[model samples]
Target: MFVRNGTSTLKKVLTCPPTFLDEAAPINEISKKYQDQPLDKAKLLDEYQQLLDAYAEAGVQVEQLTPQESMTNSVFARDFGGCVKEGYILGSFKEPLRYAEHAAYEEKMAELGIPKILEVKKGLFEGGDFAFLRENIIAVGIIERTNMEGFNELKAGLEPLGYQVYPVPADSRYLHLDMCFNLVDDNLAVAYEEGLPTEFKELLNKLEIEIIKVPEEAIFQHGCNLESLGQHRVLSLKQNKDVNNALREHGMEVIELDITETLKAGGGPHCMTFPLHRV
Candidate 1:
């Protein structure tokens, strides 16, 4: 089965081991800070294993894609594609460095026997920009990595499948919508209000979803990018103290993990995962 919504119980996911993640290039605003420092591959692998262990403990099945040495950013598996009720929507990339990663995801999907719902032929649309807010409602980002053309293409394909897709415009610096907005529960979301436009905020308000606003400082740390494990539980970065505390205060279980090595590459727990099956 495919994921019904973002906050639904995540039953299965896809990830790529950081076997070839070696450097932090100037890909985005966040990764630019670590351009001078060298990434520790050993530590990255260990941290990735910890994430895999967490998924196993949470009763979520995991499938791994064969890592390629040339595709360093493939560790951010969420950008490859997105899974829907019908099948998978293969993504297109804006950065030339990531263009080849598309074929890898297609091969993995075919190997897993997951059919393709849409291939996103027109414009750039990464999985990080797409999120299923509910069973039929989806919020996609119009940011540096994704454009209006991509949003329209996705809407045209999914609307026929009973999905309503909304475009959320955000600052290009934010990279993707998940960087500032992510659903943690059926009626709860974490967001960096300053980075989002008024229309998106109004949409959330119309849906009656409570927003846990993160501070501006936390935005660079990818604090809003968290994975919901269903049942009011979430996997977050250990350094996001304020967000974790806020989640705990809201009666949610927060499982913190040390992923400093991986963070140097401008991704968080949510970015490292691609949801496959959820209910």
Candidate 2:
């Protein structure tokens, strides 16, 4: 079945190679600083391959979406759309440059026979802002990328399906909810508390999900963007030493990969993958 929560065991996933990760045209503040120097395509490919290897080692079935030359941020597959227990929820892009990605994801979903449950037609809703906290609960980030209109639309559709949609307000600078908050275990999350609203933190506490606070210095490094592989396992960035160490201390099996090249484009392991099937 499609994933119901982020902390479930990832059995199958979709990804796109960094075929057009050009640093010249910046997408965020992180990429803007790297515009002076061109990205080393060779090194980037190597790093991406290593991520694929890590997934294979974990026994995850990988599917790839072909990237168009002009879609520089297409490598971040998680922004395309998201899956629910019943079907796929088509995403609407806020950035004009990412508008074409929705159509590509639609075609892929159709090809894979994944039924479409709802398509965001009002305002904007990127998949990066959609986070499933539990089987019947989801947190949608009401940030610059995903506005109240979009959140309302999603809530209207999902609430009928027994989902309790929570609106988490975050600064536009964080880009997406996954950037500042993500699940590392069924009962544990790694979050950059300063970047999120106090209510969001309170909500997590109310849910009994312990927090592994990520410092401001580690926020930009995508320290909180690690992926959960279920069974108390996580796929993280080798550079996020503190976060990885904390996971290990909590009895998690952390698989670290060096995706520094991909991080230059303002995404990490979690951002680079779209879950197709989870258990």
Q: By TM-score, who's the top model here? A: 1
Model 1 lDDT per residue over 68-176, tens place: 9878889899997788878999989988878778999899989999999898888889999998788899999998788998888999999999999999988888888
Candidate 1 global CA lDDT score:
0.89
Against the reference, the lDDT scores of all candidates come to 0.89, 0.85
Clashing pairs for model 2 are: none
- Report the alpha-carbon TM-score of model 2 versus the true structure: 0.97
Q: What's model 2's lDDT at 66?
A: 91
Model 2 scores worst on lDDT over the 10 consecutive residues at: 22-31
Best by lDDT: 1
Per-candidate Cα RMSD to the true structure, in Å, reads: 0.9, 1.2
Error of 1 at 260 (Å): 0.6
